[model samples]
Target: MEFTAEIDIMPLDALLDPQGKAVSGSMKNLGLSEITNVRIGKHITLKVKAKDKSEAEAKVDEACKKLLANQIMEKYSFSLKELVA
Candidate 1:
């Protein structure tokens, strides 16, 4: 089976996001101050061939934990969808 995976990695709520903060500051400077609570994260997409949905999900989870995210400071999430013709 073929599946598409989307992974998102972001700093934990308790962690400081300097890039997000900087962007927020810039927005305020540009008079777009209405946008608050800005957070920045990464999005990753991949296609995988697995025996089944469960196997595909397991692979994606491993990828997230091993390479997609830094478990110490960032939390990760992923979604998997089977591809149909």
Candidate 2:
């Protein structure tokens, strides 16, 4: 079976995100003041061949934990779905 994984990686709450803060400041300067506490993150999409959905999900989680995100300073989330032929 083929599966697609959609993932999001973001800095941990305890860590400071300079890039996010920079973007937020820029937004305010651009007159978009309603937005606050803006944070930036990464999105990743990949296709995987697995025996089943459960296996695919486990692989995705492992990838996120090992390479896609820094567990100490960042957190990750992912969803897996069977790919349509």
Candidate 3:
């Protein structure tokens, strides 16, 4: 069977997000000061081949831990959906 994985990776809340902060600062200049504390993150989509949901999840989790995310600075989460075709 095959599945699709949607992954999100973000910096730890305790860590500073320079890109997010920069964007937030610009929001004020753009007359959108109401937006604050904006946090930036990444979204990834990939296909996995596995016999079952659990197996697909395990592969996606491993991919995040081993390649997609930096555990020391970021956290990751993913959801898997079975592919219809």
What is the per-residue lDDT of model 3 for residues 2-85, given as tens digits with 9 covering 90 to 100?
A: 999999999999999999999999999999999999999999999999989998999999999999999999999988888997
* Model 2 C-alpha lDDT per residue in residues 21-77, reported as the tens digit of each score: 888888888899888777888999999999999899889988998899989988999
Top candidate on TM-score is 3
lDDT of 2 at 18: 91
* lDDT against true structure, model 1: 0.91
What is the model-wide C-alpha lDDT for candidate 2?
Answer: 0.89
lDDT (C-alpha, whole model) for all candidates: 0.91, 0.89, 0.95
Q: Which of the two, 2 or 3, has more TM-score?
A: 3
Worst 10 residues of 2 by lDDT: 33-42
The residue pairs that clash in candidate 1, if any, are none
- What TM-score does prediction 3 earn? 0.95
TM-score of 1: 0.91
TM-score of each: 0.91, 0.93, 0.95
